[model samples]
Target: MGALFDHLIAVPILLPLLAGALMVIVDDRRRPFKIAVNLVSTLTLLIVAITLLMIAGGMTASGDPARTSVYLLGNWPAPFAITLVLDRLSALMLVLTSVLAVAALIFSLARWHRAGPHFHTLFQFLLVGINGAFLTGDLFNLFVFFEVMLAASYGLVLHGSGTARVRAGLHYIAINLSASLLFLIGVALIYGVTGTLNMADLAARVGDASAENRVILEAGAAILGIAFLVKSGMWPLGFWLPTAYTAAAAPVAAIFAIMSKVGVYVVLRLSLLVFGPEAGDSAGFGAHWILVGGMVTIGFGMIGVLASQGLSRIAGYSVLVSSGTLLAVIGYGTAPVISGALYYLVSSTLTISAFFLLIELVERARDAGADVLAVTMEAFGEDEAEDAEEEVGVTIPFTLAVLGASFAGIALLLAGLPPLSGFLAKFAMIHGMFNPTGLGDGLPIGAGTWVLVALLIVSGLAALIAMTRSGISIFWASIERTVPSVRVIEVLPVLGLLGLCLAMTLQGGAVIRYMDETAASLSEPAGYIESVLTAERVARAPSGTPDPAQGADEETEVAP
Candidate 1:
């Protein structure tokens, strides 16, 4: 058991991979058993995630950052082998993804899991790819994991057939396939120039790469950046996001809140690693474009929110806002800004996930489509309706009160209003925008920083105004507003998500500290490289190439 704990990094990937495969073999008639497998797997993943973070933070029984886990596959050298390394950044992502998996899976159990075939299988595979992407240290392996994630997503995006879903799925599939092609092309160019697919090796080689190779690397980086930008929902390229997300079932959309962030994660990981201080003239190769593009993305998303009519569209635009803000923070590339942005990332993701789940419940009362999912009042496990049989009264009842309360919390979070995590996150970001030192001696706020500041405020205001309008339209303006019948399972997941956000708010200091540390670790890549390139890391890894005496029996399956 003690030894097993040392190699825990691989479990996030393996657990999901195994579970998804088993789910594929399980017949759909075994619904209860399927749900059990999914629930147990996701819950266990949540546990593993927390453990990985604790281990990284030195909060576990083994206490040291040097003890941060690295697993090399095939027992090959780092430059040639596949590797999965869990640093502060990757560990943080695993924890986040797991928490979301638990919430989204529980929410889906309410009904969406039964809506189509192999929903459970696809979901677990999605997790497998996402976890693998976050963990892998090799760029080629990253591509493989990306394809797995995308392939799974193609099925998920079309899980429940509708004309709109089919249309959106087709567009989504086409764009992503093209993006994948770009991703492959970029990887090929990088590998051709550098002769290594391992990210650590790439970083180690980049600083000293030849002038001609630098040109090749730059082009490869540009092409790769396009793929990431498209995935992250950066302008023009992300027009498909709103439509696709809106058409997706509630639970799918809820989980997809993290999809855009995956692109940001890759860019953040690769950019600083490959182009940091050690990279000489290329130290900040693409920073300017990222800065300009992030601002433009924010502007585009804001406009979409203002012009949107429905709740789903508004939520879709919010993804853009979240993505743009994170992209801009990455562009800023300051430790402090990245710190605050990390907190903002958590706050906004949980807030939006809850909002997506909540939207289905709220819309069920207003739209006939939602009514299709409606069941008897007893299905809610309540003796009676939250209100007096939908007859409005002077005093608010359980359903009304809950929706109102959740609405207020979401509004505060999304709008960055006071007392909530959203407000705290934005305040931290705004305060750190210039990194003030003394009364007259703060880091001089740059013009671009000011622009970011203005956009932050404007985006918050746009969100506030839009949310308020939607709330009134759904909650108050409708003279004959029917109370939505929500199941406890469905509502519990939303509450769990929002509660997590609130908990993050209550414990902002520790969380922010972790984010700060994670940012610092990412900003400097030396330690990360050292951890991956050690001889033990490459020559003695348990999962990759085996020694000659050990033979094929010792070797395990790795992605070809």
Candidate 2:
């Protein structure tokens, strides 16, 4: 049973991998097989959720102490082998990813069946890569998982490949491929200097390196950071995001909601581990740069959102804004701030994914062709039609009303209004910035305080104004044509995602606590290193060279 728990580390990745392969093999005509695959995905998600709950419970029970779990592939040791590791942070992320994956799958069932053969296969493979990326503990393995996810995403993104989608997909592929190359080069450099690719091991060793070696490590880390930044849709590097995300199919774009987070996850993990306070004076270097870059990203995204005319593009810019804010919080480098950032990460990802889903629904309903005015007209027509049909009152579907209300709520939350998860998350971060602790007071008293204050005010205002504009355009304006019916597939995902955002808002405390624990674990890298090395060693059995077991073990360890 204990050994089986170790296997739990790999289940999230393996289930999807096997499911994808099976999906490819199963005839499309075999409805049962497809149903089984869906069942498998749902069950896999349930397992991941249960596992995370158990882990979170354990962490809470232990008084929030750092805990680690190791899964050794083929029963070999690490360094000479590979391993899988899970901690608070990775567990939380895994659960989040699983939830989103299930939602995405459910959303796709109706529409994606019409897409083509092996659509499910591509989706499952993408999940495999995503789950693998979240769990793995090695640097090189991270790149591998990234490639896997990117490859899967390429197919998914270009699935329908209308002219616009194809063009966007090409741009997405080109940029990400370039980023991947940079990632590889950075990894090679880091390996050259540190002689180790294990993240935890690297963290332990990086602090001890000579000054010159530290310089090399920082340079490598910077390059790696750039790769992640591009993925996260940070300023300058993220021009490809809006078009790519906007042009993707609804369900495909929904999956992409998890995509940007992968970059944020890497940035959060690497920054906390590789450049933590323990890295001594060198730690501050990357932190300052991230902070500056994040601020710039926020400004850029804000301008884009305010100026954008299309709903999809607006949503895309919103993603950039959310990413920028989270990154900025991370740049602050305090435990409280990180906790806040983590909370915001959860809220933002859920909310934005929901937002995107809603945008798709609205677009479909209005036959709006992604135009802002068209969406507005549909909403208005629906409202007017309801008024006209029933002298007493036309009964709008409670689901539709709830969806609209939820979008409005999310807008409020994004604006940092009180009594919402977004506000709480931002408040927590602001609190951390002003009152520094273990994460350090990275900013100056007068200047930093003012800057943060300005950001808070500006961000809140920007969100408010943008939402107001979008809301008026979507809900109040008149439509020139009859609204189209929304497909069940699209509606289900949007509702599910919106429900999640609402739940997060209601359960902010629990979410914050989970994030706090996760951040703490990330700040302390010893347990992660031990688990990965332990698993790797158990898997390899002194193989003297990298092999399949080593690869598998490494893959498992990199999940978080």
The best candidate in terms of TM-score: 1
Error of 2 at 548 (Å): 13
Give lDDT per model, in order. 0.83, 0.74
* TM-score for each model: 0.90, 0.87
| Colliding residue pairs in candidate 1 | 73-544, 74-543, 74-544, 74-545, 75-544, 75-545
lDDT of 2 at 376: 49
lDDT of 1 by residue, 436-554 (tens): 44112223687988999999999999999988877765665443457878889988888888898889988999998888788778777898888787636323446675464244344
Tell me the deviation in Å of residue 215 in model 2.
2.8
Give stretches of model 2 more than 4 Å off. Answer: 29-32, 56-66, 367-400, 438-444, 481-484, 487-489, 530-560
TM-score of model 2 relative to the true fold?
A: 0.87
Error of 2 at 329 (Å): 1.7
